[model samples]
Target: MPASGQTAERNSHLKAVGFLIGGISSFQIGATVAKGLFPLFGPTGMVGLRVGLAALILLAIWRPTRSGITVQSLKLLLPYGASMAVMNFCFYVALTRLPLGIVVALEFTGPLTLALAGSRRWLDLCWALFVVLGLYLLLRPETMAAGTMHSFDLFGVAAALLSGCGWIVYILTGTRIGRMFDAGHATTLGMTTAGVLLLPWLIPVIPTAIMHPWQGGMAISVAVLSSAVPYILDMLAMRRLSPRDLGILLSMEPMLGAISGLILLHEALSVARWIGVLCIVIASAGNVLTRQKAIAH
Candidate 1:
């Protein structure tokens, strides 16, 4: 490439990185606000509102037509959308019992596992061990004895695990959808599909909540911050950056979530828990870096 083109490319890459960072920060803030609204709307209700409103907003922005959409694309999108809906619902449910930081950290396991999969290197195994050790430290019996884990809810933990599983499915199915359509079209259709799938749960609660203006407003905010903004930003970033680079950037999300929880919800973690968070972040970053190196070879 020519010098001018190389410079332009570097600038665009930097701009995309900035957008990704902003998107992650905004997402954590949205999650903190959503947790506060759990009293007015249960987890499922909040999921309904977020997905429903997000679908409307994205559809308006994209104005996707069925002209190019094929039945095969629709097949890919259905499972992708369903995975998204289930992931969000389960994460919110876990949030009700656990602090925002812990839930986010636990949820990080999904992507970390994805990143580490198919690796045969001993170093990769070591990185995976760090993740396991970190999680153990974060949720171990000693932490509970110190009152640092008092809020631990077994059901919430299980729900978070389920959310992680959903996340893996979402990523796999979404990759296929991304290959089939542009991000805007794919996201709009997928979110709409998720909204439709969630109707049974949403229909029962949204009608009453819509009557009260305050509840409805909060729900709209959640949709914008959590779904619309982050998704758009992530898509932009993905266009400029390699998946390895994107994964490394995404590894910062758990730390950002922990900070947001502390500042917004006054949720504090013990020293041990902080160590645990650091371990997971390091392990994730290391895994991505290693994968990139392997690709270079």
Candidate 2:
């Protein structure tokens, strides 16, 4: 390639990276904001608020028509949205009890595993070991002063893992949906469907949250920063980058969550716990890089 072409390509890649980083930062900040509202709406209620408002925003922006709607489309869209609903619920549930960074680190294992699946590379084994070490570090009992012991809530840990499973389902179904429909239309409908699915549980929560206009504004903010902006930026970045690059970029979320929590929520992690998060980050990034390498060979 010529010098000018190389420079343009480098600039393009840099722009996409910036988009991905901004999306992740927005998402972490949104998570911190949601955490602050737990006293008002609670976890499930907050998830309802976030998804409901996000659905509306997405619908407004995409303006997706029902011209091509069919039962066949609903088939994939339903499961995709269901996965998102479950994932969001579980994630919030876990977040209520665990540190934001820990919840994110656990939830990230799903994509790490998904990326590592069907790989035969030796380096992939090392990534798996990194995951194991990370998990151990995250879960192991750390002793505190004054005869205290520090540990994560088992139920919260379980919820985070379950959230990971939901993410796996979301990725699998989302890929299929993207292939079958317009990405914007599919995302708009998927988010809306997720909101509808959550309504069964959020019936009371939604009405209660709506009564206070102030709470409604907060919910809208969460929706815009967390769901709408991140999703839009992700779509844009994904178009310009490969899946592996996307995966690598996403591995930074645990750190982002940790930093956001410390700054906005005043949540802090122990030194070992920080290392545990780093291990997971490395594993997540390594898994993606190895997958790319395997594909090349």
Candidate 3:
């Protein structure tokens, strides 16, 4: 490439990195707010309201036309929406039972596993070790005994694992969906579909949640933080970033979750747990910088 083209490419890469970091930061801030709202509305109720409201917000922004809609799109989107809906619902449920930082750290394993698959590297082993160490620190028998300690709640843990799986699907599918639909339209329509699917549960709780006033505010706040802002920033960043780069950026979610929980929700991690978080952060950053250098070469 010519000097001018190389300079332009460097500038573009820098811009993409900035957007990715911004998106991750926005998402963490949103998580803090949503977690704070957990006392008012349970995670499931909060998720329903968030998705429902986000659909409306997206509709206003995207106004996706039905003209280009196709059977394939519907088929692809059905699972996508379903995964997204269930993911948020389960994650919030886990939040109700566990620390935000721990939940996010475990949740990250799904994507990290995806990142390392089929690629043999010493660093990949290191990443796995980091995750395992973090999980052990967070879920040690003694650690559970220290706090209110429902960390081992089988159902909640299952729900969180399911959410992590769902998120993995979401990331994989999002790339394809982005190719076919504009970000605003894709996210809004998909969320709307998920909201409608979830209405069956909402039927019983909607009236009570909304009428409660406090629950209603929490619901809306979750939608804005967990869905709206991060969704927008992610959409913008996705336009400029690759999946590996996006994954690397997303690895920051756990650290941000820890910090946000500590500062915003007054949740603190033990020294061991913080070290575990550091390991994961270093592994993730290493992967990103390594991949980036390879791309540059």
Candidate 4:
């Protein structure tokens, strides 16, 4: 490529990296905001509002059409949408009882597992070991028994595990959908489907919950910050950057979530837990870098 072309490409790559960072930051901040509203809306109500409003906003913005969709596409989208709904619902439920950082770390296992499953490289195995060690440290029995331990809910942990399973489904299905439709169109449709799936649970609480204007504002904020902005940014970044680069950027999410939880909600991790989080971050970055190197070879 010519000098000018090379310079333009470098600039585009930097722009994508910036978008990815901004998107993840927005997501973590939105999560913190949602946690603060737990007393008013509860997990189910909050998930409902987040997904429902997000669907509306994306649909409005994207205005996706079904004109070119096939029966097979619809089949794929149905499960994809359901996965998204279950993932969000279970994640929020876990958040009600767990710290935001812990929940995010646990949820990340799904993608990490998927990455491991697809690679046989010895270096990948090493990264897997690091992840396992990190998880063990994060969830060790001694830590829970310590005087500093917050009340831990076993059910919340289980919900987080289930959310991880749902996340695996989301990742696999989303990859397929990305090939079939424009990002905005696919996301809009999938989100609408998720909102529809959650309606039965959401309808019951709407009548009894005391809805305040400030709460409504917060809900909209969550939709914008968490769903709309992140998805759009990811889409833009994907256009300019390799998936390997995107994966590396995304691996920082757990650390960011931990910091955001501490700053916004005053949820602090123990020293041991912080070490575990650092391990996971290192493992994730290592895995992505190793994969990229392997692909180049």
Best model per TM-score: 2
> lDDT tens string, model 1, 128-204?
99999888867865536656735368898888878888889988998899898888888898899989998877887
Model 1 residue runs over 4 Å out of place are: 1-10, 143-151
Error of 3 at 76 (Å): 0.9
For candidate 2, the 10 contiguous residues with the lowest summed lDDT are: 200-209
Ranking by TM-score: 2, 4, 1, 3
Native-referenced Cα lDDT, model 3: 0.74
Q: Write the per-residue lDDT of candidate 4 for residues 170-253, one digit (tens) a residue.
A: 989999998999888888989999999999766765654435878878988998999999988887888999988988988898
Better of 1 and 4 by TM-score: 4
Clashing pairs in 4: none
lDDT of 3 by residue, 103-150 (tens): 777677676667767867676677678767776776665435557543
RMSD in Å for candidate 2, one decimal?
1.6
> What would you estimate as the lDDT of candidate 2?
0.88
Clashing pairs in 1: none
For model 2, the stretches where C-alpha displacement exceeds 4 angstroms are none
Per-model tally of clashing residue pairs: 0, 0, 0, 0
State how far residue 100 of model 1 sits from its true place (Å). 0.9
Better of 1 and 3 by TM-score: 1
* Positional deviation of residue 289's Cα in model 2 after best superposition, in angstroms: 1.7
Question: What is candidate 1's TM-score against the reference?
Answer: 0.92
Reference-based TM-score of each model? 0.92, 0.94, 0.83, 0.93
RMSD of each candidate?
Answer: 2.2, 1.6, 3.6, 2.1
